[model samples]
Structures are given as C-alpha cells and as structure tokens.
Target: MAVDLGQFDHPSWLTVAGTGLGYALILAVLTLTMFIVPWLVFSAL
Candidate 1:
C-alpha cells in the first residue's frame, strides 16, 4: 500500500541538502574505514 505524499509538507532546500550531506559523510566514513583497517593490518608485516 502506497502512502500519500501530498499529505506531508515538502522538505525545504536546507533540509534536503543536510540529509544528503549526512548520508554522504556516513558512507565516506564507512568506506574509508573498510579500506584503512585492512591496509593497516597487512602493512604491519
């Protein structure tokens, strides 16, 4: 069942931008850690 979107107020530009930036930063952190941890462990040899 699809919910009605029109019933809710649309997000403002700042709200949308903030959400996008938040997700991007979180993804970047996870990606960086994924590579960094392995590199550190392997380089210790």
Candidate 2:
C-alpha cells in the first residue's frame, strides 16, 4: 500500500525569516549564559 503524504507545502519567506530569528535568539542566550555563569561562580568566591 502507498502512504499518502499530506498537503504540506514549502513555507513562505516570512516563516523562514522567523525561524532564522528564533535560532539567532537562542544562540545569543546560550552564549550569554556561558559567559555569565562563569563570572557569577568566580565572583561568589
């Protein structure tokens, strides 16, 4: 039996742009956390 692929289609540029922005934001937060956590631990000593 053949499996049916639903009506999914390519996303618009807006959707693609939003996804890019989300990824960038996630990266920025992770980078900041890496720097901040080390400083906080050392400062507390």
Top lDDT prediction, candidate number: 1
Error of 1 at 24 (Å): 0.8
Error of 2 at 43 (Å): 5.5
Output the TM-score of candidate 2.
0.55
What's the TM-score of every candidate structure? 0.59, 0.55
Model 1 residue 25 CA deviation (Å) reads 0.5
**In model 1, which regions exceed 4 Å deviation?**
1-11
lDDT of 1 by residue, 1-45 (tens): 999867556668668888999999999999889998889989998
Clashing pairs in 2: none
Regions of candidate 2 where Cα sits further than 4 Å from its true position: 1-11, 40-45
Q: What is the lDDT of residue 36 in candidate 2?
A: 84
Candidate 2 Cα deviation (angstroms), residue 9: 16
Provide the clashing-pair count of each candidate structure. Answer: 0, 0
The residue-level lDDT of candidate 1 at 1 comes to 100
Name the lDDT value of residue 16 in candidate 1: 83
